[model samples]
Target: MNIQNPNRCFLGVSASVTGRSWADRLDARGAQTALAIAQRHGVPDLLARIVAGRGVALDEVPQYLDPSIRALMPDPDSLTDMGAAVDRLASAVLKGESVAVFGDYDVDGATSTALLVSLLRTAGLDPLFHIPDRIFEGYGPNVGAIEQLAARGVTLLVTVDCGTTSVETLAAARRLGLDVVVIDHHLPGDTLPEVTALVNANRQDDLSQLGHLCAAGVVFMTLVGLSRRLRDLGHWTADRPAPDLLQSLDLVALGTVADVVPLRGLNRAYVSKGLIALRRRQRLGLTALMDVARLDGPPRPCHLGFLLGPRINAGGRIGDAALGTRLLLTDDPMEAKRIAAELDRLNTERQEVERAVLEAAEAEALAATGLEDAGASIVVSGEGWHPGIVGLVAARLKERFNRPAFAIAFNGETGTGSARSIPGVDIGKAVHGAVEAGLLVKGGGHAMAAGLTVERRRLGDLRAYLEGQLAASVETARADRALAIDGALTAGGATVALVEQVAKAGPFGSGNPEP
Candidate 1:
């Protein structure tokens, strides 16, 4: 709905059914910027306000509206350890050494693994890959997987979306004589792992402010460097040519969107350009997956995050962990169809499991809070709750209660938990602190989400510790939480033409919420 004054609250409702107040997204300065955008670009008032509400500057509007990888991509070498990581990877490629890629079971990890595997295969090396089982192996690199890779004549190990805090496991890999190259975007600990080159933007020492890039984005940059290094070494010839990096953007877009990373700056470019690549439907497995999901017309961010991504992740969550990577890497259309159907079936099963778990968790949360406002954080534990679905439950609880939440699936003395955080609260940092305090066995993640292992006996202690550590911040975040309405739209103003204009500011999710 369009309000004449941007400073006033829309409809002046103190609170809504969702327990949130409605407020104008733009203030005095933002309203002025919107006017400037409309005058400067000769665009609609609604479109200008949407862009300006997102904090886009007058000068930045052109690029923000039409993001291109070439325009937004930073120098690959700017990332810490990029040069060393590229050199080591190039050496392996030139020497035709056996390389193993380890990835998390999620969509980002699977796509990152597939991106590397495809490129390495183009370089004439059939890279071996491993996606850890969610139930059997949990998350990240494990000692057993590393030893097995090394035992199978692997010399170089590249881990994607994981291994940032897997100091012990990578140490075991080094002991087994594997040169580890970690390409992840997760937060790291004070003591970094001993590896050839650990390239993570979120690491404390990294100057690359591209912390918003997902693991697939990091892997894409690494490939950019590796490709350049190989070309410098005169690796491409008549018999072999450089792989088209643009083709891989589809993977980057899927991973970036599915991982729920912020779509801003470079990430915006990746998803914007990558969506074009995805629309071409050149990737066979994604084609089958699109058919299975009944995705009609051109695929959008919602299609990736809600439909295709879930199906791909279903394999890792409740079925065979390797199926996602396999689907992405396979050349046979028949195999692609097979894996896509299997993933679709598993996704259905996963939804049922998730529904049951969410019901149990919601009941516990309501009982604990006694129908009043939720505590600083909610921690709910139940026996026989599927660990694979706890993260989904945590996300639901976080959304429903508007507070940081953790859902634990206990099995006897041990419990596995997942957490989701609201804005202005850092779940990963809190989890790391709990781990250091000996309250958690192990845990790590980014700002919004995390996973951990805990003792059943210490669950209450963990709850108290988190509330104590996070209460003030949680209160502040919730206090500021409100629905930011860019502009009001009347029934007649909601035209097809108006909707098309809004699409220009798109690929919106996470940090870049839809206006």
Candidate 2:
């Protein structure tokens, strides 16, 4: 077998049907490393190239292929506020104080809320929880919700997958004499919120370098810290054992994959181990969901992301936002089955609404910038559109147009918008900037996705602002948007044995593409 030159395009196909070039994923150095990997490890040449193309170092191949939780799990206290957050949680447990969890409406939020609630219940505490309505309460904690919890005699509030930007809301909670602990992963605003402990890994001052984690991942680490603290305080005994944190990996895996974070480092280990737990089908709610989704075989990341995630998300999109959390937290099989069936029906309804919105949004996007060139970014707004369905529309538009996109649902004076960004573009930062510039009422998210609110009159102004701010970066990203091919394979060269060897690299997702 002869190796092609690394400088040349794979199979000499410069341009494909997608109007994109096909190029070697491996450079000269990477090609040499692949050859070395094949020679040293005695693996198939294609498998070696795939591993090398993903930027795995020569010595790291063994660990990369086998991502163990013990090897990849970091110390819980490594995060900036883990200790302080644990202290408050432990105190709540010791004093048997009333606690409440305020979570977002998405899968990440539901899982985070469920995970925390499960841990608290194990410690002999019955914690109250809330999943806000997407349209009514919007994202993150709101004023009225906090006041309601405080009225219920809640002494401590723990917000998951939210609260990083809820400065005023958490401050209000503080005013009601409630201690707030925020365990989140979203980027923060200019001024940090005044809370008991904000245990976000993505905070500006955090040096954990664990920013790739999703909200559920952050919650898991916080629980680890809290569990340790509880143990130190003699909260566990023979009669009352500590919660088996491993059992909750199923939730972590669901949120981690559904949120679409980069599957690298700790995330890789999480999904790898979490799949093992998920395969056991121990969680009644998930098992019911699996049955409804017709998932007969073992669960994988794709199953979680495409099947189960959509059903859970359907509740937040069109139905009751609390349905997902209720489904995940339920211990009764009958209740889980009922909620799962309702979610399945809701998902079908959501698909119809999403398709209608996507069709309208695509037409609007095309008319805004004809087929010749789809400008730097696209901003599409429609009257009377479902606000909950805009995120799905924005994602579809971004994929179809190959750039950043925002789908706005207008209702008279104001509009709710959801944004999806391309590789190099930072839509979250752009939203925050728009907020600071008074172009948007409020917005916040991570790099790949975001949500925003703006006055209907300022739609054009927001579009122009985004184009000017993101043009250079979008152009640079699109210029290099070639499809990366590790190696070309002939029909005769493909074999089952080769594929089996490639299976060494398991659980691929956003950052780790399947070969």
Candidate 3:
């Protein structure tokens, strides 16, 4: 409401620079109409104006700000293959099969694994969990993981957050007679893997309108389906209490924010409910994490994104990602406290490493451009760079340059790279192209971020390839980096009441970001 940051560049509302000018213009038009409506309805002018500016229609006003899972959530049956996945998982639970959950190392993956593991155990299934090592297992389902699980007599493998792109790994699981149920949110390639059931909102044929959900959200939907199936099959009695989906929403909220997914529809509901659940302090690990992070109030989206998420991810980046997962899933308060403290320490260390990497990357970019003036896109690499922090550095470079960027850390033979991109350019496509050009050993991701492994000798080739691909995209992105405020406001509009009114349009992020 104050609308201006004195220390930062202030691009006025409807400025030509940022494409957000359209949002400002739309806000102005809505504000005009809102005034008329407010007078006619005898409503608060500020609330009406804020609601209008957020594109919340009169019909949606009641629900937009106050997210209700019952109203906003779509039936799990609408998701393709959800019924089959649920049936298979329910059958496995009834048969007392040994199940294993395979997940990635990021926050979303960790939370999803925790949620599924907890839910499955509640459903009477003894489930073991595995989170891939960032440096050793190298993201997603691996053949070695499948073999290890099989060796441990795991009959059914439930993969969360990853495994959509793991064709070979799934194939290995099949060869070992392990049935796999994949519940991921990553975009699937043309060829689908042979698995017991694949449940992902991002599948091209799946039109559930919840594709923006993160892995934890997907896992939540799976739980809903499984719970319903169990209820119908008499496996769960009505008086036994519901699965307590709300209790797990905290994890869903963390994953949704950390994965940078759009907070709309079901996602908004999850975050709204999850925030309340987080404040309840039910989960010992989460409570300890909040204490260590110095968060006293209810967890907000920014807290998950900026403060808590980074600390949880810090373990995966430089240390073991499973450490964060263990902390989130543990029941022992003392153990949770110890793990939270260690993660907090690791996060501090991670920050220092990120600072150093960013400085070196910026210097390298300036040198590459030859005039101490790099263009919109920044692509940098360094020998002995920390692999865990490359993604963080790429995000920083993207913010600094206002264009797509990549940062790679090379060891002797292998170079692990992470990338972040602007809205228009697809970083995933760039990673795919690098793979197609034989410049990368493996690469994949969504539009905004991606990861790849390259030979150290091909670092120059990777940089050149990205530069060529980003040439025109960078120009357009740089021209659109300016910020646009919704409208000019007086001190009256900056009150806590107005903040609350504006907040009704949240939980904002990615596609459904706050205006």
Candidate 4:
């Protein structure tokens, strides 16, 4: 595959510095191996090389090409604490106890909540849910919210895409006799919260390599496990068919892509299946969204990430916090259409807010020492910046700086910061460390992304701490940067069929970047 424009900016400075040149390399051995694998798979040499070059085994070519969920689906029981989570839910359903799904305000959070809510509703259980207001609640479950759910008679609280670090909140729920099952992918703090079941691939003791999964993916697996257990419990009566978890792939796929997790193995299956489901136009809310976005053709990964996800997220970000889940779960087309239109308007507003924050953050980023002049990283905090758009601003800074970036939005004495990191630097771990050191009020995340709550007074301390922690890793990652080209080819060999074959490697992002 042809590489895109090279010599991009590095930390707000132009990449084309005087004598600096991009380090591009072509692997002839890998190309030859691809050709042999292609021959074995009975495919075009060009396509074979690309897939093989990506480390796909020769025996797995067909399955990889097909991207079937069944081929990639692991036993749900493989995830740690999954059985406990499922059993708790089944107990609630069997006993006619009430449930509440608490989720974050992002796309993954919205979709994760919707998937669980939909599945429970189908299984003859009516569920209440809460999507925390972005500005008011920040992230993860809070003690007050848990108490309110308990007062409302919600016996079991299911937190998806959040709650891994909620020691205080989960403790409050436990004291009130409210059960909690946390099915989240975020890394845990010093200790996991006390709950009915904590299902996280990233938990310290969990050996599941599926930490790359988004929270929605984690929820989907929970449903899979729940189904297996419910099937054993004879809950799947003839009238009440087991919820087809496959039908939910559309939400799983959207959340996976939107969260920017690595699209490999199960993730690939989810997106492959989800893209098909999306194109079917079966979900009225999504169909309305596509109509509003003027998506005339097939829905690609780009459409999901940039188009549908943002609109859904806009509801949680600026408009109604629960609007995303409502849109995703509503069966009424008129209602879905109205919500979709409102979300569309909110997304436009999100864009304008994002642009303004980005411009201001960019200026601050360029002005920061070492950041503007080949510094290890970028950390910019501003007063009264919109918290809703800080994450987006941090993401833009990440692209421009080619390194980990933090954009903090200060509200009086406190600031809520969003961080985006490059591959090697573990911003989440850094944030977690800060939290442990009593520097941050709270923080947790994966390698690529994280969030933090810090005092305005501690901003400098946090910056100094991160710079010291990340300086070495940042240098190593930057030194490792290079352009990966498949190989050289003659003019006659380049054809549409060859391009189509390379296209088979994608739905690329994060772990499966375009090759």
lDDT of 2: 0.90
State the lDDT of candidate 1 residue by residue for 133-170, as single tens digits. 99889999999888889889999999999998999889
How many clashes in each structure? 3, 0, 0, 2
Query: How does model 4 score by TM-score?
Result: 0.93
> Candidate 4 lDDT, tens digit per residue, 1-515?
22222542222232344434333222455556677787788887656766776677777888778888777878888888998999999998888889999999999999999999998998888999999988898898888788889999988999999999899888988899888999999988888788889999999788778988999999999998888888899989989989777878999999999999988888998998899898899888788889999999999898899889889989877788999889999999999989989999999999998888888888887776545475667889888888887888888888888889999999899999899998778989999999988899888888999988999888888888988899999877776554554455799988888777777888776667676
What's model 4's lDDT at 241?
Answer: 89
Tens digit of per-residue lDDT, candidate 3, span 1-515? 21223332333345454443323423345667777656755456655665565566666666766888899888988887898899889999789889999988899999999998887878887799998888877888999878998999999999999888788879989999999899998777666789988998878889887777888999998998888887787887655555877788999999998998777667888888998898899999989998999998778899999888998998899887798889989999999999999999999999999999899998887677733256546778889899899999999888876778889888888888899988778788778788878999988888788888988788877778888887787666555544533445687668887677667667777656565
lDDT tens digits by residue: candidate 2, 1-515: 11233355777777799766678888788899999988887778888999898888888787778888778889998999899999999999999999999999999999999999999999999999999998888999998998999999999999999999989888989999999999999989898899999998889999999999999999999889889888888889999999889889999999999999988888988898899998998999999999999999989899999999999999999999999999998999999999999999999999999999888888988887975588889899999999989999999888888889899998889999899998878889999999889999999999999999999889889989998999998887767767788777899878888777777786888888898
Preferred candidate (lDDT higher): 3 or 4: 4
- In order of lDDT, best first, we have 1, 2, 4, 3
Candidates' C-alpha lDDT: 0.92, 0.90, 0.81, 0.85
TM-score against native, each model = 0.97, 0.97, 0.90, 0.93
- The Cα error of candidate 2 at residue 453, in Å, is 0.6
Off by over 4 Å in 1: 1-7, 16-19
Q: Which ten residues in a row have the lowest lDDT in candidate 1?
A: 1-10
Candidate 2 ranges beyond 4 A from true positions: 1-6, 39-42
